[model samples]
Each structure stands twice: as C-alpha cells, then as structure tokens.
Target chain A: GAGVSQSPRYKVAKRGQDVALRCDPISGHVSLFWYQQALGQGPEFLTYFQNEAQLDKSGLPSDRFFAERPEGSVSTLKIQRTQQEDSAVYLCASSLALWERVYEQYFGPGTRLTVT
Target chain B: AQSVSQHNHHVILSEAASLELGCNYSYGGTVNLFWYVQYPGQHLQLLLKYFSGDPLVKGIKGFEAEFIKSKFSFNLRKPSVQWSDTAEYFCAVNAHYGGSQGNLIFGKGTKLSVKP
Candidate 1:
C-alpha cells in the first residue's frame, strides 16, 4: 500500500487463547521486522525476515510467539496460549531490502493486544 | 547481545525551550543508529539517522542528534521545542555484530511533553 499497514488495531484475548496479528509492508520492501512493546517499555526486537527467509528469531521471548513473512510481503505474528504478561503493542516495520544497508525503517500503526 | 538505552523515561519542557534526550547503545562493531518519533495515536516516523561520516545528524522538524562513538551515545536535541513535538521518541541500533542482520534493537523510549 502506501506505508506499512497492520491489521486488527487492537485485540483482547483471554488467558490461554490464541491470537494472530497481521502486517502488510510497503510494496517491494524486502526486509521485514517485528517488535513487541510492553507498557512503559521500549519496543523489543522479536524477529526478522529477508525476502521470506527468516533470518533472525533470537528476540522472541518463547516458542509461543511465532512470525512469518511467507511471500516476503505480508506477515503474521501468532501468539499461542496468551498470558497476561503478553499485553502490549506489537509493531511491524519494513525497509527497502536488507542488502540496501540503510537503517531507514517504516513502521506501522501497531496492534494493541491485551491478554485478560 | 546488543541493546539500546534511553536515559530519560519522561521529559517536560515549555514551548521554544531547548531539549535533549539521551540515548546509548552497546555494540562491538560497526552500527547504524536512528531516531523515530511517534505522536499520540499516530504511527512512527523517522526523525534522523547516523550511519557514517560526521557524527552530527539533522532531522526533520528542527531536530538534530549527535553520535558519540567513544561514549556509545546518540543523543537527540532540538534548540527550540514546540507543542507538536510532544510525543514518544525511540532510539534504535542495527549492528552487523548484533543479531543476524538489519535487526533493530530499540531503547525503552522517552516521552516528551512540550507544554505550550
């Protein structure tokens, strides 16, 4: 689209429920990223994708959090068995490919998730 | 692990006053630094970046930042503050040695309140 777009601006899930957030990055963007922002905390890196290749997932807190950019355009962040501590905003960003080597990032509006 | 630190969690200033927000990062090798701003209920937008060359970088809205290599700091500063500048600011770093590649490590963020 125009800029990065995220789906379901807000989501409320009960404990142990599963939720999925979506992201549609700017067209032709080859590098995508996911980050989690807890209340009053900075956004923490969760994962990264370079043209459908999951280059990094070191920041995911647990196996419960999984992200994928199957076609390197649209991406989804799936959280299983959501916990109260998972309440926060999930942000997605994209760049004009990783090889470009520019640190410029375009961020989406972010999905606010609350685990009840 | 590479990480970013924001010295202040909240900062209050009057319009037209000078402002500065501190940011620091931990990295052992070459790194890319950036500053992003988010207005209330708005998406994040890039303010500035420091990839190489002169450490002093200028961004939109009369904002500037200095990257001090010795101190591992990239502090954002503006000579005059405006009420519109009241927002959340984040510092991020991308290091070739940090994660896989092009993954950003963000600071907790500083909330700036410019009272007119």
Candidate 2:
C-alpha cells in the first residue's frame, strides 16, 4: 500500500513570496497532520485535520501559515509571505484513525522549503 | 505545554554494537508514546509505540522501547545495530485529553551513525 506522500520534494522561494506544500494521505486515512522541522530539530506540530474538518490550528506558528483539507483527502499547507525563518522541512502524516485507537501515523518524505 | 526530550543529539557506534537512545516527555495526563526513524532521503517510519498493557513493546528491526511512567521516559534499545540502522530517531508523545489529542509533540531527535 502507498504511504503518505508529499509533492515538490524541494522548493525555493524568495522572501515575501507565497508557497504551498501538498500532501496525499493514505486511501482510507481519517486523520492528517502537518509538522515543521527545523535544521537539527525534531518536527513540531503545525495543524491537524479529521476527515474534512480542521480540528486544531493552534500549533501554527503565525497567521501567515494556513492549511486545509477539503473533501477529506488531500491537504495543502500554504505559507504566505515566506521568510528566512520559514526555511525548514514541512512534514505530513496520516493515520487510519484517531489517537484513541492507537493507530500509528505514516509520514511522507516531506517537502523541504527554502526561503531566501 | 507538552515537550519531549532526546538525551543524545548524536551517537556513533559500530555494527553489531548495542544501542540505546533515551527519551523523556513531560505531560501530566495519560499519554501515548512513539518512536520514529528516518533513514537518509526517506520518510519517517514507526519503530514502535507504547499505549498500554506491557511496558516493553517490540517493534520492527529488532527495536524495542520501554515506557517508564514513573520516570516519564520511553527509551529505545537494540541489542545489535546494523549499518543500515544509521538514521535519525525521534520520540513523540500525545496527550489523551484536551485539544491536543491527535497532535504529537516531538523531541529534537537523535542522529545515529553506524560504522560497519
């Protein structure tokens, strides 16, 4: 079975530009999550979605960061006005069910974004 | 706020050597723990998890983790590591209550380099 996958393995953007990273979760996954991993750091939670509903956005660092998962499938994380601080790897993961079920999340290759 | 800590940032060991990476998380409530591994140029893969029942849980590739509630720790250990085991290991935790149910808090990660 295909695991979670992210598109545009690498991206380079100028400061103040907008960038969008996409993620395709497994076929029957009902939960999706986005995380940001800085250099030499572990991934930090960014947002979460259950099916098509956005349940938690508190982990998003700033208002410039937005995410959506419509139709309960693909998700996109859009960062507006990119900055040097935004240079990091954006990771996406999906699970078959909620954490209560103890379902392990499968991660994608992640999209490395560089803002110059 | 919840946070995870990985005791070692980097570790070097020869093939067939014993390996142990320490992880500790701070959270007051019941929690779920996970160990994820990321090989170079690959996505994060689940090594094991501790939800309940047995404290010692075995995962793929001869990896296992022991969840010590009293110490707030979940340490990963392998009796013999292979050259292919060289990768970044992450410890993550998620609370069972509040708005952070499905969101994971990750540690800074430990980089393991295996010499064959």
Candidate 3:
C-alpha cells in the first residue's frame, strides 16, 4: 500500500543540461501521469502512460521533454537541454486502472528541478 | 483546452470558521471535477471528486464539494475549518471527450491560512 514516489526530491541543473526524473507508482497501478508546477501555481499536465504505452504527451511543452514506461510499472521523464524556464516541481500520480469509470489519483512528493 | 478558475487567491480565517472555496470550469460538456490540497511540505492530496450521480460529493478530512452544472462550478466547502486545514487548494477538471484519456486541468490555487 505504497503511494506514488519520485526520486531526487531536489535537483539543481545548469541550463542546457539534461535530467531524468523517476517515478514509482503504487503496486498494481496501471496508469501514471506527470505534471509540472511552477512556484505558487497549480500543476499542469505533462504526459500520461497506460500500462507500457505512452498514451498522452500532448501536454509536453516542447520536444525536449520525453517520457517512457517500459514495463507498465515504473516511468521516467527526461528533459533534454533544460532551460531556466523549465525549473519547477515535477509531480507524478497514479491510479488503479485507466478505464475505470472513476478512479482517484494518488500523488508523489515531486521532484523540484531548478535550472540555474 | 479546458480551464479551471479559483476566484480566491488567498484566504485567512480563524479556527472553527466556515470554509468555502469557489471553483469554476470553462468546458461545456460532462466533466470530472476534483479538489486537491497541498500542505506546507507535502504532496498534493485529493480532497474530493465529482464524476457523476449525486451533485454533492463528500471527501476525506471533512471536506465536500458541490457540482452545479447550471453555473459551471464545483465549489469546495467544510462546516468548520481547523488550523490543520491551512493549505493550498486547487480545483481541477477532466473533460470527457471521445476516446481521450483523462488529463487534469488545474486552477491557479487558493492559499488558505487558518489561525488557531
């Protein structure tokens, strides 16, 4: 009965560097999502995965952002050539199933990425 | 793209005061509404959600939200708030479209400060 978990609670990266944030969803969760939250702002959608398939990436701000869920369990969000504008809290969430009529999402503590 | 609005940017109240946080969405179709709370140093937690059926939905920690379709609103309320309830409250909406996976659109958030 673990909730979603993210790694590197705080990351400081230089501009143009690349960083990969990791997420571990709860056991048996089939859906995972990533979001970005600026200071004093609510989180915005980034990408979503259903099992092993990356179903939604439209929310990705740019091509530099990429995500993958290889085995339908763990996921990673890689930001290539990070910019100062990309500095924010990266959040991950998971739900039991994707097709359920109603499912509540459990959130992670989030990784605070700071592009200096 | 759907958008969520939280009218109150910040609120200050004494313990045991009645609490009401307003939220509105711009999408005109069937939507799933949610209220998430983020404590000082914690992850975002679901306060409540409204998918269908009863317009009034209750959630954990003595929180509730009412969905009013006529006004495109889903406002969160609590009979009495405690100092522990001081946190950032976010309103989100996931519009049900054709064959689309649910992705949340969140508001700017309301910062509530409850003085004990």
What is candidate 1's CA lDDT for residue B93? 91
Give the per-residue lDDT digits (tens) of candidate 2, residues A1-116. Answer: 88899998999999999999999999999999999999999999899999999988988999999999999999999999999999999999998866366578899999999998
Q: lDDT tens digits, residues B1-116, model 1?
A: 78899999999999999999999898868988999999999988999999899999999999999999999999999999999999999999987753445677889899999898
- Which of candidates 1 and 3 is the stronger one according to TM-score? 3
Least well predicted 10-residue stretch by lDDT in candidate 3 chain B: B94-103
Write model 3 residue lDDT over B1-116, tens digit each, in one string. 78999999999999999999999999998788899999999999999998899999999999999999999999999999999999999999887787675888999999999999
For each candidate, what's the DockQ?
0.65, 0.69, 0.71
Give each model a TM-score. Answer: 0.95, 0.97, 0.97
Score candidate 1 by DockQ. 0.65
lDDT digits (tens) for residues B49-103 of candidate 2: 9889999999999999999999999999999999999999999997777544468
The regions of model 2 sitting more than 4 angstroms off are none
Candidate 2: Cα lDDT at B63: 99
Model 2 TM-score is 0.97
Best by DockQ: 3
- lDDT for model 3, please: 0.93
For model 1 chain A, the run of ten residues with the poorest summed lDDT: A96-105
Reference contacts reproduced by model 2: 0.78
